[model samples]
Target: MRANRMPPAAMQCRPHTGEALSMAASDARSGRLGFNRLQRRPARDRYDGLARFFHWTFAACIVYASVAGYTLTRLANGPVHHFLSQLNMSIGTVLIVLFPFRAGWKLVRAEPRAMHGVSARQQLLAHGVHGVLYLTMFAVLASGFLMVPNGYTFLGLFEIHTPFQKGPLTDALFAVHRASCALLAGLVVLHVLAVVKHQWIARNDVLRRML
Candidate 1:
């Protein structure tokens, strides 16, 4: 019986054949490349708490501004329309004040990496969209300020003087502001669709990073 039995060492080595050895080597290479490690890192699960707060706050401000702006166009010239316009302007001013601080924080903090299986091209496209959104936001806010030369009174608390006189140039600026706003609305819709695709089609739960 002892003669017939295989050695313990041979049995152990038998399980690690050529195919298994090749698979192990491939996994080792992947780990060394940081791909596997990225998936395993705990930080990939979500953004830091402060980042989440800033994201949601900005999202709320944008939604409010968009709604107020659309309503302003529908209402006839009156006190109510004027009040809504002021509210929209106030919101825009708040965003202008907050953007730099939020951007600074982003610069200092680390961002969560793209989802594990996301392609490099998709990541690049997402970033490009984000940059365009930022540019459009700045355009809308600056043009809005220029469109009103008499300055703004913030809920009757204080006033901001218009930096320049209103004329044909101001009218042109107003047109730019309107066009930028429409572009922003379309971009926002695209962003939402991307999120839905990640969550439903890709089943990635990408939005949880911000949440």
Candidate 2:
């Protein structure tokens, strides 16, 4: 017996099946191209290595000086107090010397723009806080140095001389130092809280840029 032939309609439908496959393949290719375009988009900007280094170093120095300076003030006149006072003053002196370099670098290096979705008012507040932080840092350093009536030996490596003599002026300088120190501590706290808020509550992940 002769082999049975397919119906005309069935034969016609065969071409449609191939066409459907071709259209499906084309759709898949377009989807892949779309993904590639997304992959090619620019990444978010982050702080450079040197900027990150300065940021962490400043953070460490600030914490150490604040704690040691406060503790030494509360302790009675003794060997422990003397040692801590010397160490704290040495750290502050180094920070003072390094501030110019840090400032110059900041001036030369461009900062990354504020994150997407950050409001203009928030940006202004951030800039203001940063500026005040720098000023407060300088004030704390200068006042700490001037308040010293006598010269100090730094890290036991060499001597650092103070311009001011032991007098009422030194008292005033000490008061200023204390106030600036407190302000700096508050600013640092606020800075940290802001980061936490962005990273967790808002899910902005702003800290990653610094990292």
Candidate 3:
């Protein structure tokens, strides 16, 4: 007896639709694997190697710098404030040294997959915002270092040399740093809005890919 099979009329076939999986698909997958790259990292649930490092490193620096900025802008000049300021300044100085390699990794590595459902325009806008974010992040980090009074020395193995000798120039840098921080905050809000729009409003997993 012949094996049973669908008749020619009933047989279903797939057409060559040219459409590839959207970026969203890849993004979703990235979130699943904890990394956007094909190679999986050691930690599950934690981000990929690059993302994990960047996320925590940047977080530490941002927290230090932001706290320092607020304190410096408000403090009444005292010992406690001075000590905190020095620590904050030190953290920012470290960020300045590390920022280059962090940025270089971003530049060289393939980016996480984009969400699939968005339009080309949306994707392009996302790309632009990301680029601006990176540039501004570096600028802010550098400005934080430049804003330090007296001079900055590295916390690494050796006692690093001073970058500046006076406070006025550094203070001017602080002003610029403060202004830039405000702008960066604004941009961050906008970015969050865009992301929420895509994920919450659209009921999509666009944000998941990057998580």
* Residue 37 C-alpha lDDT in model 2: 90
- For every model shown, what is its TM-score relative to the native structure? 0.76, 0.77, 0.66
Across 36-148, the per-residue lDDT of candidate 2 in tens digits comes to 99988665478778888878888999999888877876899999998898898888888888888887898888677578778999999998999999999889988989999
Clash list (residue pairs), candidate 2: none
Cα lDDT of model 3 by residue, 128-209, tens digit: 9878988888778777666655564454334445577666887788788888888777777787788788778887765555
lDDT per residue for candidate 1 within 148-184, as digits (tens), equals: 8778887667887887787898999999999998998
Ranked by TM-score, the better of candidates 1 and 2 is: 2
- lDDT, candidate 2, equals 0.89
Error of 3 at 95 (Å): 1.8
CA lDDT of each candidate? 0.85, 0.89, 0.69
Name the lDDT value of residue 126 in candidate 2.
Answer: 94
lDDT of 3 at 189: 76
